[model samples]
Target: MSSNKLSAVLEKQIHHLCLKDFPCGYGTWRKTKDSTEGAETEDTDDLLDLLSCRHSPWRHDKSWSPQAPALRRLAVLTPERLHTDFIYNYFTTLRIVDKGVSVIDDGLLRFSKLEELVLSDNKITEIPAENLPSTLKILELRANRLSALNSLTNCLPPRLEYLSLGSNSLGSHDDIFHLTGRHWPQLVCLDLSDCEFKDQRALLSALSTLSCLRTLVLEGNPFTLAPSYPGFTVDSVPQLSCLDTSWISAEERQCFRGLAKNSDLIVDRASATVSVGRARGIPDPLMRVEENAPDFPVVNYGYFITYEFLSHQTVNLNFDRESKSDAANVIEDDADLQSNRNCEKESCKQLMVYTEETCHDVTHVSGHSTSKLTWSECMDFSHTHTYIVGDLGGLKRFFNKGLYLTIEEEKVLSWPAASEDVPLAKPSRPVKEKKSRKGEESPIKSGSTKDKSKDKKKKSVPELFQDAPIRRILGSVHIPLHSLVTGGQKVLVLCNVGALQTESEVEATQTLEKDLGKTIKEDKKKDKESKQGGGSSTKQKNTAASKGKVKGGQECKMDVHTDNSVSVQLEPVTVEFNVELEKWQSASEAHQLLLPQHNSLSKQPVLS
Candidate 1:
């Protein structure tokens, strides 16, 4: 209780308390105690100054609590050493307040329940994979220098759904697939857009196989091209159902429509005629023939007629004559005569004539044997010769009647008679003549010769029908059918008929028929083989049944039903031709005939 004694006790108690309170206090006091000489005074002064400042750090003496409340959130602006005791029980949410500040060794063990981690917009070239907590849900690593996605793979929490790895230097679609495949099963949304998926197949494959994926943003990546079909407007994304492309222009749409319109189906007879003309040597003079002869009838032939029957036919004949002698010398002189004879005897003889004046009553006959008519006179003979032998055959038969049985004309000059030479007479003696009286002496007076011999001769007769050009008339006919059935519907039949020109058209027709026949035969052989195989199978089944083997009733019935259904479905429909190409008609008429029926049928309303 005495002043001196109390002061000593207080000093001792203060020393002990200071030692226990701050460990650094003892070190500072010891350092002051150890100071020697002049340094002792300086150290004591620093100690006093620290004590004074500690007593009143603020203007008002406020008590500093020994225990601080646990920091729920702490933002550090500057790099400073944190005392272990200061942050051990405090901070839960720690955020870096300054960018480019590395908090590398900051003890983070206090914040054990940290949920959201965002280290975005920093100079974080790399983040340690193990630093991330499993409790984290949102990890934003956007706008960083993450050249590779491998860094985040192991650190990514299963519950971490929202990950923004955008604006990083991740290279390709494969990298995207590699990154996502690890976490995509649970990923509901993926943003690989603008990643530049230059390889469409890789992108498409990745997109297709992603099971949990729903929203994929793939705009601004090229691979979109025009649609497969013209006028097709629907946008497609392979298996997925969304596409975003630039709007098509009106001109492009119009072009598509024009293509579709022009592609509509058409059928016509002129097509067939053109085909025929090409096969034949017939120069498609018919192309111009229409313009030249506008009055010609136009006719359309339906599918039923063979193109062969639509051509002209001309007859050719060869005549062989036998002579008793070689007489080669006289052959040149007889060239024109032989030509005339051949014309009269061969082709002209085969002309068909119709005396009844009706097409149905037309008949044929020969010309040379019937009369001595020439080519030109044949036309006049019809007018002059009243019996009216219409053709060469009719004329021959008419003239061959008992009343006018004509024989072959015989040659008037024999070769021997023409060869006989007449000898010149011996020079005759000059005969003397006496003049009469002076007035009547004129006969011999001036330039008259005593002996005068004179001679001269000439003669001719015209022939008939000598100069007419040879004319070969060609004809053809076709029959039309009322109806034909195709695709289980009755349709009209059109066909071409009559004899065709035996030249090229006939050859082409023959070739077509032969090809068709070969095809039919091959088909028939195949059908027969199939039928035989079926019969064998049926017989085997019967034999097996007769042998008393157990069989499932319903299975056999099902097989039978299936076979019947297949047979019905596979049955080939037979097509028939009912219309034929008529005589060469104008293009307009052909068009009219072929298109009307098709147009009318197309216009009819369906019963359904």
Candidate 2:
């Protein structure tokens, strides 16, 4: 057939194939003209038979050869027939290529229209800089052996946004810095999280220049712990809005409090130990505000912290939508001020120190903000002799030795009316009923009334001493005496002999009693020696009688005389009691009372 006729037939077949569904097993055939001159000595019938043999309309076959001049305009080609001419013309917009094709050095230029080039998960490692089309926006070369980004220095498109070079053996930040400057100006995100960097300074310098960079994820890098490393400070890079430093898990929002001032950056131990204020080279901003004001607003009155919400017009502070209405209501409520005072008193009932049993509201007593530690204000008193706060279930776990006491408890214990000699009172007794007197009761009224009066006096004296408020009990088994001493708190351990049970308790009681007796006897001897060298037997007896006697296994009922009108009766274990004149007197007395006695019976025996 003529060249013009063959070209027309080829175009018709190509058009038909293009319209059909892709990868369809369809075939077409056409005849090619002989290139050699004077070779057509055969018959027309022979040429027709050859053409008929090459043609098959229904089945796919490679009859229309791409090398033929008639089929040169075809855009797509198979891997076996990928020629330079085919790539230059038809594959102009092609951005993706499958494996098994070794056409890397094609001489075509200007692939500026392509956006994404996904050559990832492939064996192609080295990319020639000049070969890459400038129009390429994304180059995904992840999971390949890319030692350095030097190859991409000249080829990196300015508009490249996302570059995933993950899982590659890219060594250091210096290796990747070759792709910096105008080459990657529009690049906003870079994932070099797990890439091994010998020094982060290169990365830091490179990142410092990426003014448009919004997010940076640096995790699993060894140089992250290196010293002299200035972290991602917000002040240093104003455009860096988000940074994942691996200090906390990604799931937590804004982990690690107290970032460097004037910068959103967090400083760990690897960084310089500089205070936020000092690092910023200014006094604390909050302190400056307070210094400007005449007086700092009072948060707590007495024992309770109260927030006074003035008129909404007075304060022009802005709050989030959720809290705005509530904030306004708080300011408008006039009764809240009065209720706050009442809350102060009522809230004291729930106040307690840490113990074995968990006290959830101890955080409240410790003065933590409510938003930080979310717990009910009410104290759980079900667990005996124990308190807890937050997740700590024991008092020992919660508090280190410190003088912690509720305002009310402190006031009651510090009363001046409490006496050391008077015994503590038991709880109040139930009321008694008066018996009705019938007709004969009037005859002997005076004698009966006198007898009743005497009985009442005897009963009242015991009741008064027995039912008095217990100022302090020293040797109660429920209370941990050793814990109090070892927990770093300075406390007075007062023991009463009456509370002793076992032989160990008795020995402990006797040891305390003998020490008290010895101290009293020594004082008396010193007094006698001071007054005169010699004293009469009667005078000695009188002096001995005047001085209080110290006894073992007996509870001393002392009336605690304090400044307050309410008198407390203190029942000390195993020894006579005396009022503490000075603050340190109690501690000194306890120390003296714990001294070992000489006699075996008076000495503290070994406890089983």
Among the numbered candidates, top TM-score falls to 2
Across 1-608, the per-residue lDDT of candidate 2 in tens digits comes to 21122123334434553322222211222212543454434333442343235463422333332322222213112223434444333322232222322223423243334565555444455666666666666666666557777777756566778666755666565565664555678877666644555344455656667766766655434343322222333323445556543322332222212122312111111210100000001111121122233211211111111111111111112445575444321112222335543442223222211122322221222221011111122212111111111211122222222222111100011112344554432212211100112233332233466675775634322222122322222122221222321212223332222321222233445666676567667667766664584558756764565454432212221211121112112122221111111111122232332222113223433221
Badly placed stretches (over 4 Å) of model 1 are 1-98, 101-110, 189-197, 207-608
RMSD (Å) per prediction: 42.8, 32.7
Query: What overall lDDT, based on C-alpha atoms, would model 1 receive against the true structure?
Result: 0.31
Q: Candidate 1's residue-wise lDDT over 192-267, tens digit each?
A: 4323334444444454555554444443222211111212211112222222223445454444332222212221
Shift of residue 324 alpha carbon in model 2, Å = 68
Q: How close is candidate 2 to the true structure, as a TM-score?
A: 0.28
| Estimated TM-score for each candidate | 0.23, 0.28
